[model samples]
Target: MNQLTVFEQREVLGKEFRMYGTPEQPLFLAKDVAEWIEHSNSSVMLSKVDEDEKILMLNNVYNQVSTHGGVRKEQWFLTEDGLYEVLMQSRKPIAKEFKKEVKTILKQIRMTGGYIPVSAEESDEEFLARALVVAQRTLSKKDEIIRMKDKQLEEQAPKVEAFAHFIENEESSVEFKILAANLGIGKNELLSILRNHRVLMTDEYMCYDKTLGKRVKRYGAKHNVPYAKYDRFFEVKQYPTDKINRVKVLVRPKGQEFIRKSLVKHGYIQERAA
Candidate 1:
């Protein structure tokens, strides 16, 4: 005959109790219940009970021998009704709390439709069947995630390759280099172009006028110029100083294709002679 297996474990009053048997016919260790009761009410005096009374209580529950560390120990397991009878005998507040906990566990088991016990000595075929089911479920979820990531990469491949090609070629335009660097395309360039454009567009110049005796905005053609023409439509800032700062025009995404075609048309970026 197959023996009941431990299906769940719960702690009450700092003592752990193992729940055994199928979910439909749940059982708790008699010793664990006794300990819980004793901990709940020190006045119950369970230890003082005679061996005859203990045996009588044991008869109400199932007895099994569990081997631990090469030692066989007899364990008494009780049904819910038997446990309730035992708890009702005790007049402690913890006993009432333990009863409530038992009700919750029973309700959960009922809702879950109870747990089926695997045989202690399961056949290799049975074990493999269970393992395969779990492995299939895990692999199905992983495959779905991998497919989603692959699709994303596929959609982004052209953009990524175009940016990479722009960065790798030394002969590429300074504007492309700056834009690529700003967009985190390559590791060599510093200072993001996008951030600089926002800053330069919002930059305000103030000066103190002697007549006014207060700071006034410096209105000039350059100061009022649109952000798109900061560095001749490159959207990049160029500082006018003795040191030469190469400023390249910024091409928007919609205009990039047109620019490329125009360059080929003008023989700037030459196409292969077919």
Candidate 2:
């Protein structure tokens, strides 16, 4: 019902077909019109309807079978079947809506027949870069979560190490054990005490250093622990201090036997008591 313009056809098929099918815009000639018609799986074909080749057949349904005239005007005329096919080709408005419709349909059919399927894998790095962008975003989020967990552990490290030490070496029954179980002092603080303070050892006994008396006194006073003359006093008492310090047990007449036992125990005098 309407005349199709060169601009309208170009809009549907793109600029490649700009000069196709008009006085100023001559359409591309098919390589073999007879072969195209003979092998027609679709209802339309493009063929020359005049000797000058200016006029073209848009459809050939009836004349394709009839022998009335060779390449007549009726053969080139756009048929109802051809117009139906053309409207299905593109949504763009065209001049001589009926004729342009047939041309549009024929153009689309020819283009589609020549089309080859494209492989997505052939795009290579373009697709890969898009994929990596998404992956990096996810990895960055995971890294942030890991850093947060590490910071929390760092803040809690001293508390965790203190609890582990209590479970490990607290059975030694050192005064530090009582202090740690009650007050929660870290390992570094306890190590500082052992280094600076004089620790006297006995068989299951405790004694304080005579050298660091002031330090022990100050430590106990600051912490509200009872301060005494001996920082590590023994729980069990054995012998007199003077006699135990003697090298010759025979010099002590009152506790000759005790002296001999002490000397033998210490490996100072080896005579067995008779």
Candidate 3:
């Protein structure tokens, strides 16, 4: 048996990439899908086929590919060897060899039915739930990923309520607006922080110094020591004086690993994550 490398194995498997754009014509493992996976993984996808010459090829192929490890790493992949093992043990009949089985699998996939289309004429709660799951599962798992995830949920969750209440009501008092402005932030920013992270929700919101702020004990205890709460927040400070000025120090809240990579590539920033 020929042992295929990772690149080659990916190429072989690329011949069966699933369709994401189409719902009604759902996933028949067509040419485009194959081409995508092949181009992505190249060598590793091809070397996993084994000859059993008995079971159905589609089941064999599905069984062979493992998606456990790579999914967590955001790759969502399976090794060629892993796929081969699945085919070997599958209840479906396998072709005499990997190449023959690959063809059979492709043909079977083409014949299989596609997804049932959902309509946008009316909103579906189930669809929303599924969307939430997808969003959570595929969310970027970086340092500030929680903030981004919360932002997504907060932004999307209000759609269900029709936002009629928040829209119809202009109840944000002048005091709240003054408070937000005092902190160099907006009312919405304060609201998001309070609702999502802080458990302090009240109609009578006000701006005050740390000594007079509600839950001052907890907040002070949490961020008491100098450079204790967030070292980087202070490290990034480029103020001429002791007070850190945010405008002078722009921090790109550590997005994807690639963002830092691109920044480093252009000499705009340096990696400080380590």
Question: Which structure among the candidates has the greatest TM-score?
Answer: 1
Candidate 3 ranges with C-alpha deviation above 4 Å: 1-72, 76-96, 114-274
Better of 2 and 3 by TM-score: 3
Question: lDDT of each structure?
Answer: 0.49, 0.33, 0.31
Candidate 1 structure quality by residue, lDDT tens digits, 1-274: 0234465665655778677655666666666776787754322433444333332111112244554343333344556676776777677778888887777766755664332234679997997677566557546755775685467557545654564465455333345555544333431211122222231232357999999999997633343223553334334445654654433344444333443443234222223222
Cα-based lDDT at residue 66, candidate 2 = 27
Q: Rank the candidates by lDDT, best first.
A: 1, 2, 3
Model 2 lDDT tens row, 1-274: 0111221123222222322233323343231222222323222333312234322322222323223223122122333333333334434453135345345545643443211223466576675565566457546755774685467557545644554454455443333434434224443343233222322221222456688653232231113121233333312222345434211111112222332233233222223112
Residues 1-274, candidate 3, lDDT per residue (tens digit)?
A: 0111111122333243332212222222222322432334323333333333111111113333323322210111223333444345333332124435444444443443211123576478876665565445433332254574456446544432332333244243223343344333454543433322222222233355576655421222222112233333222333354543321221222211222233233222222222
Q: Which one is best on lDDT?
A: 1
Indicate whether candidate 1 or candidate 3 has the larger TM-score: 1
Better of 1 and 2 by lDDT: 1
In model 3, how large is the Cα lDDT of residue 258? 25
What's the lDDT of the predicted structure labeled candidate 1? 0.49
